[model samples]
Target: MRPPTRLARAGGALLLAAALSGSLGGCLSAYLGTAPEENSPTAPPSAPPGPRTTAPTGAAAVTAAVTVTIGNFLFQPANFTVRPGGTVTVVNGDTVEHTLTAQDRTFGTPPIAPGASATFTAPAQRGDYAYLCTFHHFMRGILTVA
Candidate 1:
């Protein structure tokens, strides 16, 4: 068959452009809806794995401290207790960076790189303190001081 006329070619190009734009718009919306935010209160289903290390500082330097392990975007022993003003050591066993941040802003750790570790001191007050990973908010745990 003979090649299409110029008008036909232009029409075809416009149709293709429209289709691509629609698909791309849909993808952008999907990403914005699903991608996690820094202040998000939920965690993704999983995280990639890798290895890194960080030096323990502040309360983590204390020899006597309770251990909290992070893996699979979940905190081990999601609930635990410590003495008021006690030291708590956070071990990052996951392959991604994470944080143990108190909801009340009373205590929190720096971003603990994968396979790295950090520490924070428990609140001196007697009560339950809820915490979560600042990066992955869904990864949460409870710390009680009594």
Candidate 2:
């Protein structure tokens, strides 16, 4: 093609690329948890991957069995009430890796492999603990100690 025509074609291609990038950036931002609308209260949050709180006595003092399963980017139960001295075992049921990390200086299990399990003892006090998968920051849960 003539030099002038080729230059015009190249300019048109560059403009198309810029437009595509701008639109794609917005979609990528939403996927990366940067969307204010997603965090808004009007949007009901998903259930945590497991219970946030554990009993004081762990599972032994409770009448019901307490087991939390982690898998498929979610925590089963997502929330639980436990005694102060309770013990909670986290079961990693997902094919991918996950962690039972807790804030507030509470106990935590190491990164768990699929089909592996980790147990943590509850503190001798009532409080709430939030946890999530380290790899997938969006996966979350809470343990409520009573």
Candidate 2 ranges beyond 4 A from true positions: 1-65
Candidate 1, residue 21: Cα displacement in angstroms equals 54
- CA error at residue 56 for candidate 1, angstroms: 30
- Give lDDT per model, in order: 0.84, 0.77
Candidate that scores best on lDDT: 1
Could you give candidate 1's per-residue lDDT for residues 54-119 as a string of tens digits? 544344443345899998889987987777888899999999999999988779999999999997
Worst 10 residues of 2 by lDDT: 56-65
Superposed on all Cα atoms, the candidates' RMSDs to the truth, in angstroms, are 16.0, 11.9
Off by over 4 Å in 1: 1-64
- Which candidate number would show the highest TM-score if scored against the true structure? 1
**Given candidate 1, what's the lDDT at residue 95?**
91
- Return the lDDT, model 2, position 73: 74
